[model samples]
Target: MLYVFLSICCSVIVSVLLKLAKRYQIDVFQAITWNYSMAILLTWFFFKPTIPSLQNAPIHIYLGLGVLLPLLFMVMATSVRVAGIVRTDVAQRLSLFIPLLASFLIFGDSLNKLKVIGLIIGFAAILCSIPWQKKTANRKVYSNAWIFLLIVFFGIGIIDILFKQVALFKEVPYTTSLFLIYILAFVIALIVLIFRVATKKTKFSWPHIMFGWILGVANFGNILFYLKAHTSLSKSPSTVFSAMNIGVIALGTLVGLVVFNERLSILNKVGVALAVIAIVVITIS
Candidate 1:
């Protein structure tokens, strides 16, 4: 339970940092790029994963995750800045439903009654989470903000599915696969950042690098503690899963409301509640 608590805190902290990034003028792209370097270092230090032969590795899954992870991270940062942490966190947690849908539609899993109900509610939650009003004079609010949330929902869901595939690739150690993916993602981010610097679209900033490493630590801590929670509660994967998602949503809402004073409409509030209920139903089913 301590691990679960820590994991939840780390997850929320990532959002908090991203939210603060805008206030501090941190370059999100440079921060994100350097984040992968820290992640790579931490992966090597903690996991000490053996380098696997590339010939037998699942390169396709690696390629997909390598590209998507960093890209979606930038999207998520944008979402937090624009949509606020509460909605962004809920959208991310609800994204688990995406893989569930894939399990039924693509992988031929049998859907239960509660799953059906959860899916219905989850979709509604997504729809309700969207800020559908016209753009306000407030620069913080974007018109059709749902696009960022939806992209995060689908992108993360697909990434989760790809990670599942990585877990199933018995030929390579999972940590090794993770290490490879981090390296690839860092490479991709680096290329883009280098291009931006070269084209004078952005300049090299020490602040972005420093903040990126901090973000990486929080991001890595979230994964590390979450995995530890699962290992500690090995007999109850469902408990860990439910607790992690529910905890993040609950804590994120508190932070967004109390700390940040993020505004949410009545519909968005209802969507948050439904998102929680949907998670519970899905877990129970």
Candidate 2:
């Protein structure tokens, strides 16, 4: 239970850190690169993972996650740019429903009535979080942002499914798999950086580099504790997922209101309220 709560706190910090990075004028790519680099180092120190035998391991499983990792970062960064922080985060998190549904259909995972209700309420909250354009005079800008949001939803939804698939692989130790995934992801990002260099588009700033590393370490900690909690608890993954998701949003909202003096419009406030209600229902059920 403590691990679960800590995961939520870590996640909230990630969002806040991203916002801070932006305030410091950190380029998104640089921020992410530094973040992942730091995360890789932190994960190494904390897990002290040994390389598992490649023999008898399904190579394709690792390969798939390796590919997914960099793509997830790209899409998530773009999503944050296209959508505001809060809305983008909400969409990305709630998009886990895609994988949840896939687990039911493909894996034949059971979903009880309570889980169903939770799913409904969770999605309802997501819908409410969507930023509605109110007679905006600029049609082109609105259209572009809306299209980006859709792309974000699709990208994040696919990423969630990929994570679930990786989690379901019982043959490999989850920790080992995660370690390898990060290492491979770092290599991929390096390759991408080379391309950026060739194109003369890469920009380096100390703030971005430093903050990225901090963000990465925090992210690694967040996932480590989350996986540990899941291993320790007997609760359903869906329930755990709901708790983490709602908790991050609730925490993010509070931080935005208190630290940033950001005000939620009526619709967003309602959405947050609905999300809280859904969390309660999911936890009790």
Candidate 3:
């Protein structure tokens, strides 16, 4: 329970840090790069995943997640800045729609009444979460913001799907696989950072350093405690997953509303509220 609580707190805090990073004009990519680097270090230190045991591990998935994670993270940063944390987080949480649909269509899993209702309301939540205010980001830009959110939604869903697949392979320890994935992410991010530096697209900034450290610690804490939550509630994976998603949505909405002063239409709040209910319905179903 404590692990779940910590995971939720750290998850929201990462978004809060990203919001603060924008306010401080910190480079998102740099911060994200450092984030993966430190997260890898922490994963390795605590898990101490053995390398030789990875001889038969799925290299493709590691590479795929490595490259995709950083790219999706970049999308998330843009979404957070333009769409506000509340809507961005909602989009992310709503991404469960993809996998839920996959369960019925691809995996032939039964969808119960609760899941059916959850699906209908989830659609409404996605629409309502989009920003309509012109000055918030302009209609045109908000339209593009939807693009970012969609990419984030689909990308994260894909990542989740891959992890679900990885669960079938009992050969490699998941912790080791996770560590390698972050290593790949770190490498890809470093290459991008080097290229951006060469083109003068971003410069070395001290705030990036400070913010990156903070983001790293928070990001790693989120993942660490999330895994812990599953261990602590090994019999109830659904509870862990549902609680984490709902906790992030609820807490993120509060942060955006109270701390960041994010303006949302009445419809937007309703969508967020519906999203919370939808997630619970789907998770339990």
In terms of lDDT, the best-performing candidate is 1
**Candidate 3 segments exceeding 4 Å error:** 1-7, 75-94, 105-109, 119-123, 133-153, 225-247, 279-285
Better of 2 and 3 by lDDT: 3
Error of 3 at 167 (Å): 4.3
What lDDT tens digits, residue by residue, belong to model 3 across residues 183-215? 888899999899999999998787787688779
- C-alpha local distance difference test of each model: 0.77, 0.69, 0.73
| 39-155 per-residue lDDT for model 1 (tens digits) | 889999988999867898889999999999888987987897788765776688677676665655654456567767866776676666656553444456577678999999899
Evaluate model 3: give its lDDT.
0.73
Candidate 2 Cα errors over 4 Å, as ranges: 76-94, 133-139, 142-151, 229-235
Sort order, lDDT high to low: 1, 3, 2
State in Å the error of residue 205, model 1: 2.2
TM-score of 2: 0.83
